[model samples]
Target chain A: MAVRNRLTGERTHVPSAVGRRSRVASGPHDRHHEIIDAALELFATIGYSGTTMAQIGDRLGMRGPSLYKHIASKQELLVEIVTGMMDELLRRQRAALAEGGDVRQRLSSIVAVHVQYHAEHRYEAFVGHREIDSLEEPHRSHILDLRREYESRFRELVQEGRGLDLFRTSSDRWSSYAILDMGIGVSAWYNPSGSVTPDELAATYAELALRMLGAERGD
Target chain B: MAVRNRLTGERTHVPSAVGRRSRVASGPHDRHHEIIDAALELFATIGYSGTTMAQIGDRLGMRGPSLYKHIASKQELLVEIVTGMMDELLRRQRAALAEGGDVRQRLSSIVAVHVQYHAEHRYEAFVGHREIDSLEEPHRSHILDLRREYESRFRELVQEGRGLDLFRTSSDRWSSYAILDMGIGVSAWYNPSGSVTPDELAATYAELALRMLGAERGD
Candidate 1:
């Protein structure tokens, strides 16, 4: 059974005709994205270690062997989820920061972007936060490196604010972590159907972040 | 192999003689506490679902069956770790709030106690946060009930502050969760051996919490 990539021409296992319906409909790339979406849901529900490749296939109505055609391995699925989410976070964070204003405005923008990401990417955020320890080898270190890079952005922001006397606290790593960590908490329990919209939550968080950083209100 | 609980006088699983030694050391109650402690370490390292009763027993220098004399099943161990930590958190939070003066002081006190609890019971906190989905039936709901109650304290504090015009934001449950969630973040990444002590972290978090609440600096 030759499960081949239509585009890459890479062969591993044989996907059924139903699984390989790329000549029409959504195309191969869309199917690949769907496979990842299915895997993300499973990872959030059952965790990375507990989820099997077959389960991911089952979720997509495909055979377990056929999933190999789209993705290399379950580990790859996790790497994709963790790294992909980190990349998105970094992108959003950079864009938010690039909007560029005073320290208070910049910090508020950062908070808004963060909470928005957590709300929109709840499953990805969950897998990213909870499954770091499940990763082995290069993946673990790579993800940690990305995380450190992201964390440093927050710390640097706080430091810049401190230098400008626009923010308060000890202006240390601990203070930065406190603010950033609170943003991360949104992924754990933010209910989309709840009373608050993502914008509302983000607004409130921006206010909280400002207060936390000791930004002078009404400035 | 007759393993009788000398305290409860109940026979379940028979542990080896090496496992039955209380002659020269801590009693059965202490052994029970130790089992939970060892399990907490394993949970933090490998997660709850990945950890086995035998692994927990081995960590405590006892056989799996013998460990049962002190503790019960893995589910029970998880239950003990999560509930015990919640019980402790509730106690400490209540104590801290009891010593409060005004809304600012109360909120600050809450944040300090929360950060302190996260730092002190990191393993327990980690397991509690990450392993909630794995708990079955009554246990999951029970733990969640306790969590909701704990969360409501913060919400109530925020509400009280808002009533007095001391706090900003919408004064909703979401706002309270933002503050509480950041405190929960401490358990995920707070390093005890780092330059920041628990007191220092708590102090910073308390100040941040106040700022988040829109408290005036001089107040």
Candidate 2:
């Protein structure tokens, strides 16, 4: 079977029989995932710069040295958290766009997706925003490309909406930035313990996003 | 003579002779400012965690150890950069509000001051946002309090506007957060070599802030 990712155009081919085993989850792999989750919490709270391998391992009840056997380094975890979210965001955004609605419907879906992703992965989003400069080499450029691509999706939506005369703005690029920045800010302040649920916040932001583009209220 | 800081509400007594002569500045003080300017650039580029005192010193003309004579520690520089900005922003925001206009006019002025401050002090603003968690206890709480006060100014404006029927939003607090976040983001991406000036960008944001509140266009 051959499959192509709709957004990134990444393709993978898997023999039907070989692909049937569900990628063979193992103890090591499961532990790796746990380590990444722990790492995300530490990195988000203390910052990637301020966090250390020992602290990440301690959070998982493992020794610092043993963590090296499971994960390469703190940088590896940083790469995983940052890249995973961008890729997932691109996936969800593409899926939303594929639903195929009018500009307003699509815009609402996009806003919802943006807010939901941020709320769901607050730590990853926080680290991804604040720690970009900490990333070295090709990884840095790769993530930056993904971010640009993610943001460009909204810009394209604005451009198409403007073309249809459904949206109004003096500058498409700046307006698009303004819209994205507002939703993006949710990740920074969103808290599970807070009164507002992700769904409620997303809904509120969707309405506000429409208003930002000059859409009438209750329309 | 006596003096009071309008932004911070600090009171001090000043002997006219004691305060006289020195707005011209001194070598040590000037060097300290230069070091801060240098720190801002390095911290923004390298990520505060990755940047070292040696690197900061390298950015200036001094050797790493020699740099200690000018600035106490990297943490000292961080504190100076972050708090100086919070103090300055509060001052500017208070100044704008002091102008005293209609609700819409006051909101516009607040937005303008926010964007303009962020743009002019891009590196400081970037560090302030990204490095908060890197700070230790008392400093961290102090800065957070200052940020709270800064944001409360916008919240008060939103509340007053909502009271006047000039601003419309379900949650004044969240909407105020959204408005401030949008302008705070300008610091991250605003480029001097870019097409627009800070004043122009602030005007655009001021209008956008009004739109996000569901205000009538050109009203």
The candidate scoring highest on lDDT is: 2
Q: Mind sharing the TM-score for model 1?
A: 0.85
DockQ of each: 0.57, 0.48
Tens digits of lDDT, candidate 1, A58-167: 88777788888777888888888999999999999899999998877887888888888888788999899899988878999998998899888888888888897877
Positional deviation of residue A102's Cα in model 2 after best superposition, in angstroms: 1.3
Supply fnat for every model shown.
0.79, 0.58
User: How accurately is candidate 2 docked according to DockQ?
Assistant: 0.48
Model 2 alpha-carbon drift over 4 Å, by segment: A1-29, A216-219, B1-29, B216-219
- State model 2's lDDT: 0.83
Alpha-carbon shift of residue B140 in model 1 (angstroms): 0.8
* lDDT (Cα, 0-100) at B56 in candidate 2: 77
Q: Could you give candidate 2's per-residue lDDT for residues A74-114 as a string of tens digits? A: 88999999999888999999999999988888888988899
CA lDDT, every prediction? 0.82, 0.83
- For model 2, give the RMSD to the true fold: 14.3
